[model samples]
Target: MTPPEHGILGRVAGAVTGKVVDAVPVEEILEHVDLDAVLDQVDVNHLLDRIDVNRFLDRVDLDRLLARADVNALLAGVDLEDLVQRAGIPDVVASTTGDLLGRTLDVARRQVVGLDAVVTGLVDRLLRRRGPAPLGPVLLVGER
Candidate 1:
């Protein structure tokens, strides 16, 4: 039969339901229930499909996550030698140093050549010898 609709019986049923609900111990009822059994009846994939992932992620606290990280200990765990080897830093440094040493030697060689030229000019002036500073170990007719 249909439930009572808007009459003395409906009012009386409402009053009785309210009293019964008030008298019931909801906490005790919950304690008697098996949560695993309830969960087994749930459709997890359907629940996941209904969830808004981006909205859920927006509620995450990123600062609190970073605060839990140990940065100093993380750095201490790194292998610097392995890192340098992987990056080929030693080869780069060796090539750069080799180029620097070569340039330095070239500069020193040029300076020594300039000093030799100056000494040759001075000797030619003193001996009254002219003809292009005696030209590489070959003596002129006026000298031995």
Candidate 2:
């Protein structure tokens, strides 16, 4: 027989055989296959690279998925005491307080320096004044 005749015969035989077989028999047949060995032979990175992530994300409902999650139960699994112990809050607070106080003192020093300049300028002008001071007037030193 020709190859076309063989192909037609094969399709007819496959259709007849597929009608007799079901999912349970398919599962039994697959039970004999070593899935772990098959997976080990496959390139996972190549397989993942072929997947359409955007199409997968488009089908996902994030809100509904999150709603199904037990958040309080998840939180309960976390050890808060352990987390706090690991955080070292006292050391952090001390370092932060020291930095804030240092910054504040620097600003205060700048303001004091500015005040000293103003006071020194006033004193120099008063010492250099030549004209007679106005009587009963609120006199700015050295003003004509």
Candidate 3:
């Protein structure tokens, strides 16, 4: 039978083999490899299709993931004014402003009506009209 491998000789042989293997650089091995052929063999679409999206999402810690993200940096990359304009925010603001102005004008008109009564009373008092003074109609200053 052939000599049985063990002890000091076996250990030395193993060490020498390991050192020789280690001496062979990975870059030298990669240089000999056909990278395009290796890439062609990989089915990326098939691998992705095998992934369960819901299960993957369930495994994800969304809040923790979001906490790690730089929100201010992300926002800095975005044009907020442009985004608001695209979302029709300006139109909404304009419509809301118009509604508010219309309501304010209506309120002013009501207040002016009360002022008309007060001014008419003052005018009647100046004219020295006796008995119950009639609250006259609103007279526009520039109207015919």
Candidate 3 deviant stretches above 4 angstroms: 1-44, 118-144
TM-score of each: 0.51, 0.43, 0.49
In TM-score terms, candidate 2 sits at 0.43
Query: Can you rank all candidates by TM-score, best first?
Result: 1, 3, 2
Please give the RMSD to the true structure for each candidate, in Å. 6.8, 9.9, 9.5
Weakest ten-residue segment in model 2 by summed lDDT: 133-142
lDDT-wise, the better of 1 and 3 is: 1
Q: After superposition, how far is residue 39 of candidate 2 from its true place, in Å?
A: 21
lDDT of 3 by residue, 16-130 (tens): 7689669988798788889999999999999999999999999999999999999899899899999999999999999999999999999999999889878878987999887
Better of 1 and 2 by TM-score: 1
Candidate 1 regions with alpha-carbon error over 4 angstroms? 1-69, 138-144
Question: Distance from true position, residue 50, model 3, in Å?
Answer: 3.1
lDDT per residue, candidate 1, 4-88, as tens digits?
5667877888887688679988787678789999999999999999999999999999999999999998989899999999999
